[model samples]
Target: MRMHTRIVPLAMTTALLAGGTAAMATGAAGAAEPKGDVTAQSCYGSARNYTGTPGGPGRNAHWPATGTYAYATRNCTDINLKVNYTRDVRVCFKNTGQCNGWKKAKKGVWKVAASNVRDGAGFYIQFKGANRSTGKIAY
Candidate 1:
């Protein structure tokens, strides 16, 4: 399978690498809404939301509904993941086993700026504890 990659801005990259929550502040304003096949896991109060184009199957209970989660303008650029939960949630940017770039969100809506997200690589969000959601960019 062919992988797609992109380039992002410097400021965004710097902020993400610094482990800052600046990306999260952006929220969903002017951001593209998630669209496509959305599958919800039966946990943490099952919910409904939009799904993007690139991702895996939608049955993994440990992960969020798998599908195209977000879109970016360029390589290493920024993709936003909007989290709407009622409590603090942990979001892992890439499924790298470890939540290395994971960010925490309080009760409310949050737009997580996933900076430096490369192509061939997708985005995944684990809400609550076991509800892991997945998405990717295929174009």
Candidate 2:
């Protein structure tokens, strides 16, 4: 009876230790992975009213008022946009004159504006129609 009690406790302790070690290993592995898959390096642009008119000839069709540039904090492959209201918006690379097609983004939803964007690239929000806009940019 004494031997049986001692063996049972020893086995339980070993099993508990092994389970804990496995859990720790899993946590470590997860920590090493990329934090965000779609928006790895996200930068937020505060919500603000965009008071601008539609673009005309000689001016970009999607212009007038633009949001601040959200620069990539880490290397990323795509440029994403999100807004608080359903509006027509596009992402333009700073100083590159490269812009993506205007996409109608739903409120609080993420929309991919451009892909193959390099790290540290700066991008800003352009509106096709004027309205209050707010959201984030990530790659």
In candidate 2, stretches whose alpha carbon ends up further than 4 angstroms from where it belongs are 1-70
TM-score of 2: 0.53
Q: Predict model 2's lDDT versus the native.
A: 0.62
Mind giving the per-residue lDDT tens digits that candidate 2 earns over 1-139? 9999999999999999999999999999998787665344433232223333445544433322444466654544666566556677777888786877887878787676676777787776676643445555455
Off by over 4 Å in 1: 1-48, 51-63, 66-76, 90-96, 130-139
Q: After superposition, how far is residue 34 of candidate 1 from its true place, in Å?
A: 23
Compose the digit string of candidate 1's lDDT tens values, residues 1-139. 1222233455567768666455554554426443432211111122235332222355223233454343323433334444444322233545464443445544344344344556545455444443433333111
TM-score of 1: 0.33
RMSD to the native, candidate 2?
Answer: 5.4
Candidate 1, residue 101: lDDT: 44
- The predictions' CA RMSDs to the true structure, in order, are 22.6, 5.4
